[model samples]
Target chain A: MTGLLVGLGRASLSVFERLGRGHLFLLRILLGLAALVRRPRLLVVQVWSVGVQSLLIIVVAGTFVGMVLALQGYNTLITFGAEQSLGVVVAKSLLRELGPVIAALLFAGRAGSALTAEIGFMKATEQLSAMEMMAVDPVRRIVVPRFVAGIISMPLLAAIFTAVGVLGGHFCGVGLLGVDEGAFWSQMQAKVTLLDDVVNGVMIKSLAFGFVVSWIAVFEGYDAVPTSEGVSAATTRTVVHSSLAILALDFILTGLMFN
Target chain B: MKDPRLMEISVGAFVAIGLAALLLLALKVANLAQFSPPPGYEVKAYFDNIGGLQVRSPVKMGGVLVGRITNIGFDSKRFQAVVTLRISQIYNSIPADTAANIYTAGLLGEQYVGLEAGGDDTSLVAGDEITITQSAVVLEKIIQEFLYSKTTKSASPGS
Candidate 1:
């Protein structure tokens, strides 16, 4: 029992140490600089991969979630004869919570995993080493572009998800469930405010998620041990760690901002 | 290697365009006029419960959104929720004796403030407090009350 306790303590300490590393600060600065220096083609590929590629998944998931929210919210309100407030329920839930967080998670799973794998592969192939020998900073060259791309794409994708999700909720709640269309829209217009909550929430979540994803990918790639096996392990760790971190950070930020 | 410089420029342009598009879309959706309530018409209502009542929750009259709940807070003195509503320009003529009720939508939907206009010809001006108010009737409490009443009735045979 004592041995097990010791092992657990050591393991937990290592995890916290990894999380508290200062490299992430440097990585953020490097990413910003690279984004400033690099031009068109890098940007296009980043946009295409991060925004365009992830579009379909975001739309599909957002729509369904919206539908479910409407169905559940509408049913609950109906018993109390407040069916008119369905619009406010749908709008506030989507804009404040679901839209940004869900979209970011989807982006992390899709683009974020791919980024980790690609960078890990380059490390395995010694391309990163070659860049180092050539005096080209690999962090700036490879990691920064992806980082900048993520930050830019996340908010745009979140907005798209929100708009589509609201429409989907409308279709389910009003079209299928027999809610008055005018009442739905009017309540939505009355309830959703831009500056105080919705806009601020979306922006903060997207940017933080982008930063977390890129940092994880680069950290895993840089520290990958061996050649092939190490790279593979790093790739897996990148995906899992970044995804979990996004969720954990989301809760913390939400408490700080909303509660 | 692909030119990092070129990539950066393209990404910057892409982000700029995307932000612009989102701005346009937000403008179209928000329709600025909707945010502006009438120049001189505010009212306060009290409720026992205001479930799911967000800041922008509508104040409706016969299913029309005439105003919005601008603020909600607990009134320690009254031991009720004090809701401040701003009526739009077109809805500036609400009668002084209007009754406000805390209402819910479908089961589990949102809660809102519903207004019933009185027959009085005097229009309510800004800073007026709504005297007639109905607190929300929670479904769970009603169910519990009904069950207790049924048990009590069954136990007593004579009365």
Candidate 2:
């Protein structure tokens, strides 16, 4: 028991130390430089993988969550005679918390793991070493594009999720639940603000999460040994670290922004 | 060779489409107008407590939403909660004697401002203050009162 506790303590310390390193800042700078350098082909590949591939999942998940929120909120409010607040609950919860956080988690599961595995495989196969021998800056050529794509993609995806979620909530709350249609919309319009909280929170959280994901993927990839086992381990660690970082950062950002 | 430049172009197109979809969704949301309050007339109410009174909370008159709660604040001097409501222009002719009451719909349910129309012929104007009000009857207080009364009744009967 004592050994297990000590091991957990060491692991926690290592995670903090790794996070404190300038990897995230370096990633941001590399992404900026790549944007300036402008490799159109890499950008296109990223756009396909990050944006186009993600659409269907985001739409389906966002809509269902919204519907559930409406159904549950309406049922509870109806008992007390305040059923019209359904719109407010659905809109506020989606815009403020669900949209960005859920989208980021989904993206990490899909894209972050794939990114880590691809790079880890390249390292195991000595492809990265060959690139280094050829005087290529692997960070510039490999990490920067994916990092830039993640930052750009997350916010756009979050926005889509939020919009879809709100529509779904409206469908469930007013159409199915029989909330006064006018009352539902008017409450939404009055409460939901573009600049005040929703947009700002989404933008900041998405960007921070994107950085964490990309940084974890690259760090795990670079550290992988030249073995299949090493590659698998790196991929698993990347997903776990990135997802936890996204959740932790979410709480911190929410406290700072809302409090 | 699968030209990387072609891939980049395709990705850019995809991003543009995604953004367009979002814009379209935004427009759709904007167009789905249901409960918009009418312009020019506003009613303000005061409450002792407004639990679950969220921004965009509905303000109803006889089960019809006439307006929305646009703002909430505390009047430090009076030690009361002030709620600003924007009534629809159609309902501009509310009587000056209208009473606003904060009530809960259910246990652990949302709270809203319920407007009880007055019999007075004089109509309320914009920026009118609703002075006649009933504060929210909190569940805890009601439960405590009920329990206290029950205990006293049982004790007196036994004695």
On DockQ, the candidate that comes out on top is: 2
Angstrom error of the Cα, residue A188, model 1: value is 2.7
Candidate 1 overall Cα lDDT vs. reference?
A: 0.76
Candidate 1 residue runs with Cα over 4 Å from true position: A1-17, A20-35, A38-41, A72-84, B1-33, B38-159
The lDDT values for all models are 0.76, 0.77
For residues A217-241, write the lDDT of model 1, one tens digit per residue.
Answer: 6667666774788888877888788
Model-by-model DockQ, in order? 0.19, 0.25
The ten-residue window of minimal lDDT in model 1 chain B covers: B24-33
Worst 10 residues of 2 chain A by lDDT: A190-199
Off by over 4 Å in 2: A1-37, A56-99, A124-136, A161-197, A200-202, A226-229, A254-259, B1-56, B70-83, B88-91, B103-109, B116-123, B138-159
Residues A147-234 of candidate 2 have per-residue lDDT tens digits of 6777788877887787788889989988887899987876666555554445465666777887777777767777676699998988
Q: lDDT winner among the candidates? A: 2
